[model samples]
Target: MALDTLDLGVLAAIVLAIVIYFTKGSLWGKSDGEDVSVPRGSSRDLVEILAANNKKALVLFASQTGTAEDYSHKFAKEFQSRFSIPTMCGDLADYDYENLNEIFTSIDGFQLVVFFTATYGEGEPPDNAVEFFDYLENECDDLSNLKFSCFGLGNSTYEFYNAMGKKTVSTLTEKGATLVGELGLGDDGRGTMDEDYMAWKDGLFDILKDQLSLEEHELVYEPQIKIEESVLTIDSPEVSLGEPDDKYINPSQEEAQSLNEGPFDHTHPYLAPITVSRELFNSDSRHCIHAEFDISDSNLKYTTGDHLAIWPSNSNEHVFKFLDILGLSEKKDVVIDIKSLDPTVHPHVISPSTYEAVVRHYLEISGPVSRQFVGSVAQFAPTEQAKAHASKLGKDKALFHEEVTSRYLNIADLLHVLSDGVKWTSIPFAFIIESVAHLQPRYYSISSSSLSEKQAIHVTAVVEQEKYPNVDHIVTGVATNLLFNIQLAQNKVSNVKPVVTYDLAGPRQKFAPFKLPVHVRRSTFKLPSNPATPIICIGPGTGVAPFRGFIRERVAQTANDISVGKTLLFFGCRNSSEDFLYKDEFVDYSKKLGEKFELVTAFSRETAEKVYVQHKMLERAKEISELLNDGAFFYVCGDAARMARDVQNVLIRIMMSERKVTESIATDMVKNLRVLNRYQEDVW
Candidate 1:
């Protein structure tokens, strides 16, 4: 209190230093302060990016799953090496719109090509890229001199093929970004996507070559990582398995229900009691299972949208063969370190965990192989015989289809056939893991109402059977097989149990083996909060899964003071008499919920000309228009990529014809429906 001015001055100086040090950022960053120069595409980080002789080109990919990302990374590497154009892979979220605008506002001759795969990965971006893309889409940008190209990967089977790509290209063009090549699209369902991309690549490169206006050196293979034998081994990568992340990894259930937590997961799977499994169709050739898992534990609770991840083991038949070829079944403890020349690639071509794990849960060595895989590993062939055989198999689709897919054989089986039981390549285990999608859960549309059977989850799926040109028949769907086993246990038909004697249980006893690992997903696709809002459901065949739950909910609830919306369902099948599934159940439900439900059936094979759900909607255009005018919501649950699109088209036309609305008007209504969450389709 009595301090002199000098002492006070020193204290103030110290305080000022601390304030200036911490608050300096705000002082210069003030909106009204002196203007600071900002780069277009380059952010503050790019400002400090040390200049090099090679120019930088930003490559951005809008990927759902990892497909677009994989391809984008591959191309980026090629661009870096061949043209010597230093490349940086950018996510849409990382840079600001203004930063990108700055990068393109001037005569910077660099390019920004976007690889987009339309459709949601977990409803948008592969759980990793959604926020970034959303930011770019929302933020306005100025790209006067920027040149870009778009390559979209989609499934023609789905209605919204390359939708994101189409929307993206339109928006960027609006912002004045010049396009370098024709917008590219790849379709996966048709299986022509890869070659289609290859076809487009030539034309794409021609345009890129012109726009880039740069010389091309010889394109040579340069892997990003160095592959060596057992030289660089680390602790096996730890898999988080289940346990939800930020996005609520639990199932999408309409109501709370018990869930099984353990005795099942990526690492340890619950050999849940399979109560029921049966053939959905009477086709001996096809394999489909209708299974119900006993979820008696609160920890195993699931919502409707959650997927049940099943840890699958290679069939013992295939496992034994793999062991024979690798000649390592007896050497269980001999651990191997894998290092691929390409770090992007996995080091272990097999299982990184253990032999017991491989046979029990890892990918089988024997199965259908891709042309890409054959072409990729061809260089590693040990002999001329191996090279020729591999090259032939890679190019010959017929051969691959007949020998691999038809038999449902894995790598080990094929090698046995190819090498006549010779020693298999000492391929690393990690490669197999990287090549295959982690054993994803086989999702079933809950076929029953949660109210009636809170713990029971039901799914309807047709078995798959394909016989290639003069080849053995093959049947598979790892989880489906388990479903079949569940039916057996439920019926007590055979003493066979779904649970196997595996390491997960550590040889302990259980209720006869085989546990189903499942989780629930919460769904926004439930009945409207106001049940009075009418709904039009169009689903073909098994697409009717979710609709079942929707109807069940309406029936189970009391109607004392409710405006139960009229429900119109359009279901299609091959033959009405034999394949009209849940026919009796629908009739019973309709009788009880009269005026609240309407069932429409279309059979594609009933007549020579095939009729689908879309045709039904068009035929009832007048009625549909009236329903829409009454504010009815549209639900297309079956095929989002195709049938959904087709139904949407019919809806738009109906609006145009009956409502006397323009096509643009109809489109606006559709977009509004989307924003309002009215036009919802759960197609896969």
Candidate 2:
């Protein structure tokens, strides 16, 4: 059969089309019939989105760990429901701010823009909000017609407390945007962030009502998402039974092997194996863990002072308790599909997932109950008496604090008490999905030098367990307990019962025995690049994690025939014999480094006066001042609430005494050192 020129051309085009289809158009620029101009999700323009959706209010969040985003969603929901205004909540990263002024002109009537921003480390904007902040600072000039409000979530322990929120409000006001209410600041350091937010929100609502002449209606439960029971079972390949994403849900063997491949990030984590796990402290009452992760095959990289984020699932105890309280115990394994009721809203959790899997892997059901959330759920209480009690707990802040906050009662615990053995069956599943915050990864300081153990990351953690005076239940740390149980499993220890049981064998046993979903987060806390630079470290307890890495890094440099400088470490613990961490290792380090390495120990319990690291620092004030004059770097990593503050004050006092400077001048000198990057802190 002889083929003509036209026939051959057509055949060649058909073959190319098949190749493009199989490769998803990667082999070529684009598929022949593909429309590349179609929008993937939503319009990035603020004006276009607001006008298209006919939204009167837009709530945006710049969040690092999702706290600000959660608060924004709560605010948006409340504002819309109470004032009968159409509101849209979105991430700052998803929007284009060049048309900020257009939103004011395009949207008719009283349009509002609300910002819920969190100040990241060192007063930096969150990664998602960087672009928006850049636009606000550089491009935005006139927003005279715009009206906005801002609420900042911050830890006062940090020097630049609420910097982002304050900056945003200030910038907006400078651009002539009228503020709807006073700038709100929530202090996480004081553990009054929730209370602060609620108070600010109440006041903001009052202002909004007056400004818009809005008549508030009775608050009722409204579901932002719709959940339907699907016919699929938990065993179905289409259902995600604790899988992170579609790639892990019944993946092929080839895909499974490559699951830990590169580009690991917040959205995707590498399942790294735990190569080493052991107890650090000798005390029987207090436990501190030292675990190492094998990232050789995973290709996950880290530096000496970086952070390792560990993704953890809720314990079976908490998961089951949550299900039992919600009356979903019988239907734990029933698959359900979730859909967002509003066009602007998106489902946070993956579907079709079982109730147990959602509760275990997605939602944060074990945290302290929010007072506002308690009030919202009071209407759904089973009995009138329960409703009254719930309402009182929600309204009376002092009483609520005494009953719930002081005792550390989680949502499940509170519900169990309110129900008095009855299940909250009337509450909608969608409401639960909307109200509860999503589970976030826990971060730990990487306590290993990348130069020495390039393929491994180390974590030192103190197992947190608190028992309040009158509370029958003990509050336990989630991630630490998970690690402890994993350590117990890996060590083949049979005598000790598990503190909290987790699904160690992750979805389909992918993370069997001892493996964790982890990723590295780059940190600014780092040792000076020059090896000869002198360093002074103050770290108490597990705060010594990064300092260990720094010392190891110097040791590695010296092994390579590099000249190392004076290394001074001030470490504090309860008793030298009982809770002293890495005692033998420090001794070995002292031997290796000789006169260059010095370890100053402060055994608080051993001394009746309760001498701490600050006391030790004061004793060697002259040497510390001499080191400062010699351009030595100062580092502190410990409790931000007390220890970090104390260390800083002591440093200032030492400068005042040794340098013959005033107290104010010494304080300014420390501040200058921080600005020059000569002083660094990794507190809290």
Candidate 3:
């Protein structure tokens, strides 16, 4: 039993490792060092994170992109700031649901668990939430001791409004989990998600006030992260100037080529060449681009009726404006390192990047400013008077709406309007990244059929440009305008005034042939399994994208000597001469389909009275009713707020009138169609 110095050192190291394992938790996908660095935006185990943070309640989020995640973080902060509750927010995908039962025994409090889930496409859970959802529904059952609260983020326009939220609440209750608050539902379709959330939280607080003995505190601004300025310049080889990952930041020729080989996905998109790009419309005021992406070498597969999510960069115009307002114009190229002060929270965007990179490639500097964000940034106003003005505006929801949201004024514009051209230099850079959402991918319904062309994905996007009454700058969509620029360059179209430009060459000329960063998002809106199954499509404007795919598939089926069923498409636009999308192609398809296909047109601006798709649907009530009776699949892809709602009502009326059924019966029939997957939608 001789204890040598080396033996003692080895023993000490083993003890230290065990201590770190329990205290700091697993380094799981992190660096194994004294100072660990977790990858930005990556999820960690919720149970471990909560334990390490010494938290009581854990807010688990099932986010599709980042909206649900944003809400979860906001709720966590509010729970702490308002009620003095120690909370931990985490992604549902990052934790094991099997250990959920242990939470009741581990945390000695009433506020144990909370769920925030976003419903994606029909009643499906988000991609990340899929595994967790399966476990909850199939595996885990006994959750009697689990006390939880729930909230749902969804669009009311969809048939299954807040479906995921409802499912989560019901499943948890069925499994014997104690529900704390009334399940909150937020509808983005009504443009009142924030209001709905606030209303729900107010009620939840009333319940929690007595249950947790919570005390309201004065709201104060707190930074979740801290920024460390780096010595690296924007031009430095190691510095990532808007490059998506480390591979793009600094890659050898072989590494770069290997990166492009396979697994072309959301994280690493293939720079697929654009084979075709042209204007689909003949309108002087509006422009719609039809672009075909060559995915021959991408190893990416997509069926008809799927979505192509194009990752877009912020326009230079908006980037410059934001940089100027933040007084980062002079130091745009200055590289900075962002790290989360709280071990539980992660930095929103990838770091070791320049200010210009973060602004141009990551942050959403275009959308309407939130009242909470306005309040958060008010303390950093250039002057005391400006601060007071901003604070007052933030406090008054109506005034904030009237001044900021109503005017579509973003953060840069709001600051400019309040400070009268003075810069908000005192505001921390980390706050901008945390406050503003990341630039999301614009999902377009695929217009090309997989049967017609397996190696290409077609997109029909109408460039959205709106001019406000008093605002000088035209509000142009970032992704649509980017697509327009790409089309211009591809077709050798002359540079038009007000056309938004991008770094089309991309970082280091990676995209050589008019390529864009994109990924395929599989959608539920699909053609029936059998070619003989009838289909009735209602698509107005660019909503006609997926219907185009469906028709193309039918045309291919007919060419192959396969018998096809009756296909009816109700399409609406301003006028057939100007804005009718794929006019020539439809004519060719109609020739092949003959009696099997029917195109119902609605030109709103052609006559004194406006005629929409819903009106066209009513005109063909007998046909639609007959088709539905024969088990026809109904598909709607367009404006969910008005067009989809109207078309749905028209269909119900058709069922009532033509079938001679009661309104309730017609409604049940429609609901039954949805339940049977006969009703499909691809609306935004």
Strongest candidate by lDDT: 2
The total number of steric clashes, by the backbone 3 Å criterion, in model 3 comes to: 0
lDDT of 2 by residue, 67-137 (tens): 99999999999998998888989989988888787787778864689999999877889879999989988
Off by over 4 Å in 2: 1-40, 252-258
Q: Against the hidden reference, what TM-scores do the models get? A: 0.68, 0.93, 0.91
Candidate 1 structure quality by residue, lDDT tens digits, 1-684: 798999999999999888778764446442212122431234524312212212367667665434676566556666666677766554454444455555543325555544544445213444335565565578766666666777777766664566676766777788887777878888776766656665566577776678667668765445433322332222323211222221112235632122334433433344455555555554334434555666655455555423444434444445566666656567433434233332112322232234434344444343455555565445555566876787787677678666655566666666666666666555444444444333334445666666545776666665433455555534344545545544554465664433222222211122245455455544556667777888888888878877877777677654444557888999998876666767778998898689889988899998999988888888888888778778888887765556777787888888788878899998788778877878887777
Instruction: Compose the digit string of candidate 3's lDDT tens values, residues 307-417.
Output: 998877888888888999999999988889776666677765777888988888888788777787788788899998789999998778799888887888888899999
Full candidate order by lDDT, most accurate first: 2, 3, 1
Candidate 3 residue-wise lDDT at 645: 79
Q: Between which residue pairs do clashes occur in model 2?
A: none
Error of 1 at 394 (Å): 4.8
Badly placed stretches (over 4 Å) of model 3 are: 1-46, 82-86, 108-110, 202-207, 252-255, 261-266
Q: lDDT of model 1 at residue 274?
A: 52
lDDT of every model, 2 decimals: 0.58, 0.87, 0.83
